[model samples]
Target: MSATHARKKPFLRLATAAVAMVAALGMAACSGGASTSSSSSSSAQVGDRSPEQIKEAGEIVIGIFSDKAPFGYIDADGKPAGYDVVYGDRIAADLGVTAKYVPVDAAARTEVLASNKVDITLANFTVTPERAEKVDFANPYFKVSLGVVSPTSAEITDVSQLAGKTLIVTKGTTAEAYFEANHPEVKLQKYDQYSDAYQALEDGRGDAFSTDNTEVIAWAIQHPGFSVGIKSLGETSYIAAAVKKGNTALLDWLNNQLVELGQENFFHKDYEQTLAPVYGDAATPDDLVVEGGVDTTSTN
Candidate 1:
């Protein structure tokens, strides 16, 4: 489809289809609204429990990306591993439960939490005011800015250079909204996953891919010839964990947990385990880690 036509109407349809995957899983799992379970625990339900209830259950299911690396992804052993997963492990441990992770994409992470498909989400979730209206966010845990990655051949050094080029972005990401509102001259090709957007860039189907500065930088370092040419392009933002709106008990517990974790430099440990091996000295802890709700970047 032409970019303009897709932008005018069909983009929402595609975004909905791509992110509302839990609904699809529900359809495949059982007859209408009937319950299902894993051997270890029951399926999650929306806002049905308090923190005490969740702790009693002995397991907390979390939604996280299985494709985006450094934050969340599948490891060589085919298990979820990354900064988010490592932090999730700590969350579960603090609550005296085991952590079970469900795959999520940027577009669907909030929906999964709202539907009770997961108790919490740590998929590099940014704390925008619009999202805060839909779900409650914990204290900010990481700071980020928009970044654009293009092949050195394209030489896209700044936002202005995007004038007539196509920039690939993930559905439901801030980058998609940024280009639409601020750089309407640039054509956008939105995909469901970051991996897909990056693949489009690799295949020469899109001139560049834009997302969180931290992520694209790590990706560029791991690959070759591509670099994060435009870092800090849009309003600075923060990433945080989220829960269903009004889930106060769980939200409060998470906030307290985050404070304690910060006191211990917990995210630094997570970075070492999940990020350092790939990033080496390319990124310092301060570059991505936000502690104790301290990163108060304006989301307005």
Candidate 2:
């Protein structure tokens, strides 16, 4: 199988089963305007310097997903290669620093950044109020919507159909929080890693799997027997790089970089070059693909 095909096949089977369960149990419940504790009364203090200062430090370590395909993953040669990895390398190169890749899972992203294990987190993290309280987010570079996937044999159609069903989701993802607040009737099967939750779904553990629509669509395309039931369930949001709280200088630099890249349609080009093969004609407009800058204060 081709690399993309190999990467998506397994996820498709797993997602299909998990999504079915979510439908049966009901969608997750949603809480309006809920807030979490901030790291400090004042924004967490971080070093104030331009991008040049960070580069002069020799290397910029970026925390990235190690198993999620097309975002960040180890290639056949055992080197990190993915959309996030490509972006991280470009940022490092532009700053004249060596890019040191630190493999991180979903749950460890914030902790790694907080502890200074990595200078920045380029791990496809969704921007949410809960997370914003802990880490400073740069301008958003990409946007993705939530989607549900089910097996060919299942009858799930919309999010409402997920009443009282069991759904498998990767822990620490926006999908988890979204479902938890919106579909309280649905029982969630959470896993620390995507691979593990996906495996559980394949083993006849859940009814359906929930995640970004882009990811589900890619997986469905690779697996012939499965299909995405709810293509666009709700609001779409941008995915941004995470920096330590109160890192205004670094955050500002990243924001400027994003704005420049947006003006040149660099993110669109990256999507077309890296994501088009798997997504093909299914890709949406450039506006949906590129979200410009981050809005840290915005709740909606």
For 125-181, candidate 2 gives per-residue lDDT tens digits of 888888999999887887887988877688467877778888889988878889988
Cα error of candidate 2 at position 261, Å: 1.6
What candidate 1 gets wrong by more than 4 Å, as runs, is: 1-47, 296-300
TM-score of each: 0.84, 0.80
lDDT of 2 at 293: 73
Ten-residue segment with the worst summed lDDT in candidate 1? Answer: 32-41
Clash numbers, per candidate: 0, 35
TM-score between model 1 and native: 0.84
